[model samples]
Target: MANDPTHQFLVNKIVPIEIGGIDFSFTNASLFMVASAAVASGFLYLTTSQRGIIPSRMQSVSEMSYEFIASMLREGAGSSGMKFFPMVFSLFMFILTANLLGMMPYFFTVTSQIIVTFALALFVIGTVVLYGFYKHGFGFLKLFVPHGVPGALLPLVVTIEIISFLSRPISLSVRLFANMLAGHITLKVFAGFVASLGALGALGVGGAILPLIMTVALTGLEFLVAFLQAYVFAVLTCMYLNDAIHPGSH
Candidate 1:
């Protein structure tokens, strides 16, 4: 029987060890999460261990990363965005690390899972809602109704806006999950070709050679995608935060 390449991304309980009816054993997914964090921490620590007036290469990279996120917040969320800089910075770093680490062979890609992405989306949406209410009280209700809509159209417009607002988490999670899942599956299918056809097949083997080359190219592309997806995720979060902080503003 052949393994279903599409379903290969599904999570499995590797240990399945139960304690008093509760599964407490660490999973491959959990392992990857810790590994991703450790790798990110180690890399940054090693690179930035030496702080100098002139700035070492590692320190330069760290400074550059900080500037990049700070600039993004300033542009997307404005100057007041600085107040939430720590939250935004941590989010970007964790996501960027998880994504980049997942590119390694045999490493689990947690972000490729809908559950993981959904959790992230839910957190972002929840933060926006909580903060909006905290900052503006019931006035945040104004967010659902645009300022210039006619009284007759206000109800309908508010209804639609509410629905769209509720769907943000779903859309955000699905976008990331679908992209990662599709890319990884395509890579796996092409890899299967190289293994199954490249040895004993006819010119099919030569055809497989092209896919082999493509696999290498696609691997590099996936790395870029990992970073890009993280950035997209962060940017969207900033946009949502902006909307929450200043509802009805252009």
Candidate 2:
């Protein structure tokens, strides 16, 4: 099972519990998610605990992460969006830590699950909807109505816009889930090849070198993809929030 590319994604109950027909069991995915949250919180707390004139390494990393997310929100949604810094920063750190932790041997990748990713995406879009309506009321609907469209084609454009708006969560979730799933699968397949080839004979051991190299390269690439996907998720969330803040802007 360990050699199976898809086996790594299988969810197994660590502590099964049932309540009135609801199965609320703790699983590997849940464990990793809790771990990710803890790691992010601990890192931030430890790094920022001390005040320094010249920053320590941990302090520098903590400050850089803070500034990076701050700048992203400012650029995407403007200064007003800074109000969402806590949520956006937590989202970024959680996902980033989850991705990095999943790279470790025998660790579960929580974000690789569609349910987890979709939940996060839904939360993002939900925030946009809630804040948009709360702040702008019916004016938020103008977000679906692009400016300067001719009246003749307005209905069709509105329909297209509605579909696009509805699809945001699906696209956002699938992008992260698919990338992690595919990358891990590829890594596992190459790793399996290396193990299988090396177990054969001297000639097979020599052949294993190529797959081993590929696995190494793929691991590094996956690390980059992990961070990039997290950044892309954060940026998209900011853009969506921007639409809520200033509806109908081109």
Candidate 3:
């Protein structure tokens, strides 16, 4: 057990089982991902199963979430983009649940791992690219060409647009993963400081108290970061989708 606290990144095979030489073994990260999916599914299922006229608490929360995302899509992507509501909604719910789940003790924060976040970001960016092509045919290539640029500068401008568009997944995935990883690492380090110093008498105890206070404050901020990161991911997805739908001016 490394005292560094970030040793949690190591994926140990809990079952230690393999099939067809493939590493399909269960690990802490895998378990957390399953838990996240189950929790999200269970929450939405229960919330929508019973629709009361006045609405139950869970139902109200669910409805509010739907409306909230719908409003965001409407504003960011416009009414035409409402077609993507379900995808956006699902993305938000999945990320939000995963984030909050990671905050629980002993639960693995899969999003802290670049592999998980990169997979998600790839899926989203891939979908946008595929849909852009499907919607516009070859004309989607026009996205790389900004309007109002002089013919002489078109190549340079197009190259820049292409690079920017191609970098979407890298930037998007990194933002979330980096935030979760850094925040958790900070919390762990502060906690270690408190533990190590509190062992010393009197003066050390007093010093430990400050780190404890900072730890609590950091925890609250982490919670907010979790939500904000999820929102940022979904919003960026919407913005990219919007660009695909209407790749007009620069």
Candidate 4:
């Protein structure tokens, strides 16, 4: 249906290619993911290309983004976390840009897909696990054991903590996926309302005014959500990295 809210998320294949048994087709989702990365990379590169004693507006924006991530890392994982700055920064930029781009009518929102968000979340958690084990050996198991638990309750507490730790990827992925999916679907529904109502001649246009107003309001709110979801993802990543760096701290 033309008014279906879910239609916007359909992943159409742009290039149908299969190698062996695997579908290696380039798709709308793939295109948007590439576009998101390119836009984020291009903006940062262009903004910071020229060395300036006094920063231009673009340079200032670039510098502020760098500082923002730097400060977030310092706070969340301490100075040692600086080692992962490049990865964290890239994730933040790509997610934020992808989110904002989806605000434009007809643009694909890759983050709205659970597969994409879940893959990103898995990457973050995988990094935490691999690095924690590599750096701490068996000591990384300390992350599951809180200090001062009674011997009787220790097994139960450990079980709960283990479950929570294992569920991190699902929670992280779902949070971003659900927010973007629901927000875009809601926006489309309200937009469809305006168009549908406005189609009924003079009387309907008047009714559309309320829905139109709501559509406009929701647009602004979605923009805020775009930035916030990116920040939340990055912050959680930093916290997970912190646990890896100091696994025995509780």
Residue ranges of candidate 4 with Cα displaced over 4 Å: none
TM-score of each: 0.91, 0.98, 0.94, 0.98
Candidate 1 off by > 4 Å: 1-3, 6-20
How big is the positional error of residue 194 in model 3, measured in Å on the Cα after superposition?
1.1
Count of backbone collisions in candidate 3: 0
Writing each residue's lDDT as its tens digit, candidate 2 over 1-250 gives 7699999999999999888999889999999999999998999899888878788999999999999999999999999999999989988999999999999988999999999999999999999999999999999999988999999999999999999999999999999999999999999999999999999999999999999999999999999999999999999999999998999786
Q: In model 2, what are the clashing residue pairs, if there are any?
A: none
User: In candidate 3, which residue ranges exceed 4 Å CA deviation?
Assistant: none
Candidate 3 residue lDDT tens string, 1-250: 5448787566877877689998888988888888988998899889889878888999999889889899999888889999989899988888888888988766788899998889999988888888888989888888898778999999999899999998999999999999999988898888888988998988999999999999999999999998999999999988988887876734
How accurate locally is residue 147 in candidate 3, as Cα lDDT from 0 to 100?
75
Ranking by lDDT: 4, 2, 3, 1
RMSD for all candidates, in order, please: 2.1, 0.8, 1.5, 0.7
Q: lDDT (CA) for every model shown?
A: 0.82, 0.95, 0.87, 0.96
Model 4, 185-215: lDDT tens digits are 9999999999999999999999999989999
The stretch of ten residues in a row with the least summed lDDT in candidate 3 is 1-10
> Where does the lowest 10-residue lDDT sum fall in candidate 2?
46-55
Shift in Å, residue 203, candidate 1: 2.6
